[model samples]
Target: MRFVIKVGTSLIAPGGRIDTVLMRALVDQLDLERHEYLIVSSGAIASGMSKLAFSAKPKSVRLMQACAAVGQSLLMYTYEQLFFGKKVVAQLLLSSDDFTSALRYENLQHALHELLKLGVVPIVNENDSVSVRELVGAFGDNDELSALLATAVKADWLVLLTNVDGFYDSAGRGQKLVRTVRRLTPKMEALCGEKSELGTGGMRSKLRAAMMASENGVQVAIANGTAPQAIRNAIERKIGTYFPATKPAPKKRAKAAD
Candidate 1:
């Protein structure tokens, strides 16, 4: 089954730059799998900040957008370099507007279908350069974008790779991790905190995004991105917090014309 994987900035860029080694390891495992894979990544802004030598994070929207524009190319280039001999990888930067309009949505889906059909892995990310403040949450972040992309592509599973192992009982206070959460509740919402240092969209946003994925008939999981063969393990149901598909599965649809 095809999978849409969302790799958070924390896992990809722990500091202010891209963590090439970790990224390569993850990509290596994905290359070994026969299943079709799509990656939704977040690290452009951080990458840009480093390249531009910005002492601190961008404050103004214009500055942030500029950094995003600059970083997106570098980020994609790094991915291309890493997967140079592995597979054909393509960059797909999106914004909420791309999904809001019916025409754009259909067009985007067709493009993605063609890419996947050609055995090319599509790397998607939000267009943070021209991002709207209203779209900064899970829906706007790569985490939520990945979940939505999974539904858009009719993927079988939605895997979210983050710094944390999985959803916890409390906001990092409780020692217990929610290994399997059948249903996300309000209490769980309270337990989740804000986003991490390396990324935006915290546990709260992830839970919210998971609800959207579950409603769209996609099985979701939250796992540590740095784990050894984490994606493969998650597929085998071997690790992290596994959230069952509570919604109906996607139905077969006509393929886009070649």
Candidate 2:
């Protein structure tokens, strides 16, 4: 089955830098998966900030963009090394316009299909290095980018790997974890928490991304990226906050004769 795997900054760029140990482990997990997979990764800015010797995410747009510029190359280098000998990895840095523009969108779709057809793994990320909107968080960033890709590709599943294991029942005692969410509702949406210290997205953004993909007929699962078995568990439907694919809403019936 086709899969879109999104790993956030929390797991990838912990403590404001690329966590090599965690990344290697995640890569090992990916190596075990025998199915087709596409990655939507976030952490270029967070990882870049450190290379520049900045202690934290910079406040200025120019600084963030600069960080992204530096980070994108470094990020791709790391991925290339990890994915070496396993498969050929291609980097595709995109902006919001890539998905919004009709001609660009078609080209992207064809390119992605060709890559998958050729057994090449495309590592996708926002072109934060030069993206004004992405640098300022003024549009749908990686979370939504993943969703858009899932919809466009008609993927069977979209797996979101976060720092946390999965969504929890906020009002439940001890905040009970909710597994296998069959429907996305208003109450469920309210359970989302705030964004992480180093990333633009949070449980809220993930839920929205899930909703967007689910509405387009793709199932979703939210799991912990750091777990050794996250990739396998999610595909087996044995763990994570699973959102099953639902039937599309029926079209309105024609009006009866007056």
Candidate 3:
């Protein structure tokens, strides 16, 4: 089954700059990978901030979009350089409209299918420069955007890489992490903390994304992006948090019509 791995801004940026080592590690793992993968990446705004020498996330929508416009190119450049040895990387900017509209949705699926077939990994993100509502709303984070993309592609699994190891009972107080979650509840949402200054989404957004993916029959996992082999570990179910698919769907045929 194909996997949609969402790399959060927090993991991409360390100490207000892009962590090239981490980027290389991730792409290195992708180098010898067996499964077809799509990367839903978030860091344009953060990259913009770094370029403009801004100390904090901009409050104005226009400024935010402007940063996205400038940073989007740099973000892709970084990926291009890091992924030079591996499969080609294609930049895919998406908006809510793209998924909400039927014609566009089908087009997106077709495009992604072709890209993957040709050994190209689609680097997806919300069209921040174009979607104003998405820039200001809670859903601005590409966490939920990634989940939506997973549903659009009928992905078998969705992996959300965040700052923390996983969801905890408290905000780094009671426990270090919540190992596995079969289902998400209101209580889980309540435990989510505020958004980081470097990134838009918090644990709340991740939990919401997991719920959305689960409802669409996709198994979701949230884990620490800082871990060296985090993505590989998650894929092997060796560590981090796991959210199993709870939503029921039509079962597949046992065999091709015999």
The lDDT, on a scale of 0 to 1, for candidate 2 is 0.82
Give the whole-model CA lDDT for all candidates, comma-separated. 0.81, 0.82, 0.81
Report per-prediction Cα RMSD to one decimal: 2.0, 6.9, 3.2
TM-score, every prediction: 0.93, 0.90, 0.91
Candidate of highest TM-score: 1
Q: What would the per-residue lDDT of candidate 2 be over residues 1-258, giving only the tens digit for each residue?
A: 678899899988887789878887887876524667788888999889889999988888899989988988888898999888898888998888988899999899888878777778889999887889976665455888898888877787889999888999885478877887776788877877778888888887788888888888888899998787897898786487888777553232222311
Segments of candidate 2 deviating more than 4 angstroms: 31-33, 171-173, 248-258
Q: What's the lDDT for residue 185 in model 2?
A: 81
Candidate 3 weakest lDDT stretch, 10 residues: 249-258
Candidate 3 per-residue C-alpha lDDT over 127-167 given as tens digits, one digit per residue, 9 for 90 to 100: 89878977987465998898988887777789999878888
Candidate 3 accuracy as TM-score = 0.91
- Residue pairs with backbone overlap in model 2: none
- List the pairs of residues colliding in candidate 3: none
Q: What is the alpha-carbon RMSD of candidate 3 to the true structure? A: 3.2
